[model samples]
Target: MIYLDNAATTRTAPEVVEAMLPYFTEQYGNPSAIYSLGSAGKKAINEARRTIAAAIGAKPEEIYFTAGGTEADNWALKAAAECCAGKGRHIITTKIEHHAVLHACGYLEKNGYEVTYLDVDRDGILDPESLKEAIRPDTVLISVMFANNEIGTIQPIREIGAIARERGILFHTDAVQAFGQVPIDVEEMHIDMLSASAHKLNGPKGTGMLYIRSGLKIRSFIHGGAQEKGVRAGTENVPGIVGFAAAVRRALSRMEEKAGRERELRDYLIRRIEGEIPYCRLNGHREKRLPGNVNISFRFIEGESLLIMLDMRGVCASSGSACTSGSLDPSHVLLAIGLEHEEAHGSLRMTLSEENTQEELDEVVGHLAEIVQRLRDMSPLYEDFMKSRRDRT
Candidate 1:
């Protein structure tokens, strides 16, 4: 099968797996234990922390390991709110954030905190001026994503961080999709809190990290043993952490080469799809986009139906629809970008990986063009468009 959904998750790299295998078997000891084997495990954890910290220009002590991006996001928001409880009760974020941040904000709102969800422009970008306008005296935190997951639009995080720093509000960014794909320096960005997931960068699942700037006082989100300097409480998954560090190292070391290759293939796919397909529109920014993301909306067909068709042809892709409470609803991210309900329903997200080749891109474009045409032929919207065209003729 041709896998094209790297944004959701990536396949673990062989080197990462090799680096983790020894820990799962030979180094099978709790990091908190004091015996020789356990000491080795503890040392491994510390090294992983240092590696990950260096990747983002943070101190090893400031990096707190968690279950994944969701947990990190939760910890960042909850801890920030609790730390500044005496100072304020308001937060700011964008509408295009992952559900992790949005739901956390929702929970905060229910508990008497105020939150401002800023709108995005047509290109799915949050205006820095709009963010400045949203800040009130009570606003204590600002959370925005480093890059959008579905549409691949990179936000003006450095500008937003500067704004937040000048205002004395804490800045947090969900960098789950941007960590391995782009260059990040927390010190230069002035980010107080940052979230990253291992699986998104070809490392193991169930492992991630939250970077909290040192000297910042934040309450603990989890209470148990003093695993992560009392900031997070849990037994360390030694294997996953090792794999995460290895993956981060490899991805960063080869980022320039991988990025160039992925961009070439991505541009090839986009050009072919737009030139060969009918009644389709590309979503997200044309140039300032991720190296391996292509989101498109076919005018007449539902995204789910097209996805199934592509799957049948051995191609994997995703739609922006959600199965919430057993009812299918259009994706909030799609709607937030100004797509109508029906238009949003027709959205397809195709994320590429560096491993994909030009041959794979060719096959995917060919299959997707066929599937979209087949689905549009049965669409009522297509009939309407045809009728309108005939009337104009």
Candidate 2:
């Protein structure tokens, strides 16, 4: 099968699985216990923390483990708002963020904190100047995604971070899609809070981390028996943590080579699809997007039908984010970029990984072209447009 949905999640690497086996069996003791086995678990967690921290140029003590990116996002937005409420009750974010951040912002809105949903350009690039103009005296925190999950648009995070830092506002970024795939230095970026998940980078699911910039007065996220130094609670997933570190180390080692290969194929895939498919538009910035992401919209064809047909043809792709795939509504990301509902409904996101071969990409594009053509042939929207053109001619 040709699998091209790495933006949703990646296959767990074999080395990551191997690194987790010992933790799941021999060192399965509770980390809070004083026994040797338990101490081993605790030590492994610390080591994993250090590995993740070093990957982002953050200190180990500031990294707090959580269930995944969703939980981390929820913690970052909610806790930061509460902690900084005395100073202000306002937050700033963008419309193209994953639902984890969007929903968290919504919840904050219902609780009386004001949130500004900043806009992006047609290519899904947010202007730092717009963010700068939106800031007010009451704005306490700024949250922006490191990279767009659906369109693969990389944001101007450094510029945005600098703007927030200059104003003394707490800056948070949801880096779930960019954490291991791209180079990230939290210190250099001036990222006060950041969220990442292991599953996005070929590690086990159910593991993630939040970096809180070595104390800026954020409150406890979860209240229970003092886990995560009382910042978060509940027993740790030792095996998951070990696997996460292994994946990070492996990704770091192969990042340059893997990224170059993926980027080459990504451009190839985009070129083939756009060159072959008619009435198609590429989503996101061509030069500033992720290395292995290709999102396109085929006019007059429904994205769902195209995806289903591609699946039948042994290609696995997605219309949008996995979380919102069930919803019939067009993608929020697409809409934020000024796509009409029909165009948004026609959008398809095909993300790749190091495991994806160029041959597989070739297969996917062939299948996609056929599927889009087949769907458009049966669409009345296509018929009407063609009839109008013929009459005009």
Q: Estimate each model's TM-score.
A: 0.98, 0.99
Model 1 over residues 55-169: C-alpha lDDT tens digits? 9999999998999999999989988987887899999999989889998999999988999999998789999999999999989999999988888999988899999999999
For model 2, residues 222-254, the per-residue Cα lDDT tens digits are 888788988898999999999999999999999
The regions of model 2 sitting more than 4 angstroms off are none
**For model 1, the run of ten residues with the poorest summed lDDT:** 319-328
Supply the TM-score for candidate 2. Answer: 0.99
